[model samples]
Target: MRDNQITKEFFDWIRQGNSGCIFAKLFVLRGGDTPWEASVIRAETFDAPTVEAIGETLKLASKRSEAIQLILPNIKTPEQIARMISCLCKNPNWYCTEIIPKPSEYTSSFLAGLRWKLPDAVNVNWVLGFADIETMPPTRRAPYTSLAIRLGQPGTAPSVAKDKPNEVRSRKKENGLVPVHLADMPTPFLKDDAIKKTWVLTEQTAGKMLNPTPEFRTNAHAKVTFALPMDLRDSLIGCFTPVAMDSKSEIGAEEY
Candidate 1:
């Protein structure tokens, strides 16, 4: 049939490594038949003159074949974009094989938040869903304490809880980072004073901290956060005394 032949040819075109697209913030680039690099610049906005200035960056990146982003807008029209994309397969300096049309919301938001601070290049492997992204690099100062408290007897446990209305994944351990802001150095709360000890108080003064003394808060870099591991959860058998507290989050309550 005519349709069958046309479909075969279209699939063949893609199968030959002639073209492809990814749904991330970047498009994959190939030199010869091997994918060696990637870029944020898309062919749909083919502003050739604007990219002329950064042509060398593209060439160098392609040669190094590093996965990084470029600042180049594309042109209009699918036909025009096709021509621009096809150009990637040709010239050695301009060997840009595939052009990804759009970026996912997660990838776009992640890149947008960091591009201002790290405009040059961001490691593709650093995004979410990838391997562990170390909040504090191993090269940094060693943690003074890593309290891993558990409640119930531990054995085999599922990574996520599914019995409830929603499934919740287990949390990884987080290091408490110390804060060293200049304004916090003078407010010490660990002095000999009965006047300040009459009432039960949580450290919400001079900014706010849940745990860690005010003196220790300024000296050590730490944030007040509390999270319980799902695997350690156990139902109480005795009478339960309920305790509740009011709190506000900087962002707000998350829906999903």
Candidate 2:
């Protein structure tokens, strides 16, 4: 009876936009069952909205015993970013976002070296061996992050997640259970490079991001990614508009 009430109230709180870290700590500390089992139970029972609201909490529970996800920004080409931005324009939420690092040697010939530089501060492959970010307090996590480390070492790769948002969205019984992927988007802006040129965060800023900073970097041979702390996600999204002619606007600047 007590557990049932606790679970119900936790989901309610999350639906109201309260952070899930408090309940997550309790779940991690006292629950008799494994976190993944709990997550599956919730996934099976809750409606879509409830699941989405408490997604991070469920993710936190599922990852309590293991590593949480990590972010590797700036890994995509102009065309890839444009495709993603197009998808995001229509459906702002993606169920799972993958970070598959490609070597710089694979880059285009003309702008290969000048376009991007891989992180120099950390061993970008440590994640392949260790697997996961330090499970921080759950807020809204970025879908299901699958960090792909391409080394051929056995047991060194993260498995692709089975239960992603696309599957869940298609499974509502009303819609036919056909998955919708990024590639399915019909009108991706392939020519857009403006956003790429203006991206600001670098390895220096991104390293200070997570709760407990990681010891090593991902072994990316090219420009992997750049990101900010998750708390500012909403504010950041609000600023994702077209850059004006000057492109010199700073935070709180009148010109912006």
The 0-to-1 C-alpha lDDT of every candidate, in the order given, reads 0.21, 0.24
Taking the tens digit of each residue's C-alpha lDDT, what string does model 1 give over 42-134?
335434553464455444553443232331223322233234433332332222111111332111111100001012222001111110112
- Candidate 2 Cα lDDT to native: 0.24
Compute the lDDT of residue 34 as modeled in candidate 2. 19
Model 1 TM: 0.18
Which structure among the candidates has the greatest lDDT? 2
Angstrom error of the Cα, residue 52, model 1: value is 6.1
Question: How close to the true structure is residue 10 of candidate 1, measured as C-alpha lDDT?
Answer: 31
Q: Assess every candidate by TM-score.
A: 0.18, 0.17
- List residue ranges in candidate 1 displaced over 4 A: 1-54, 59-66, 94-256
Candidate 2, residue 168: CA error in Å?
Answer: 38
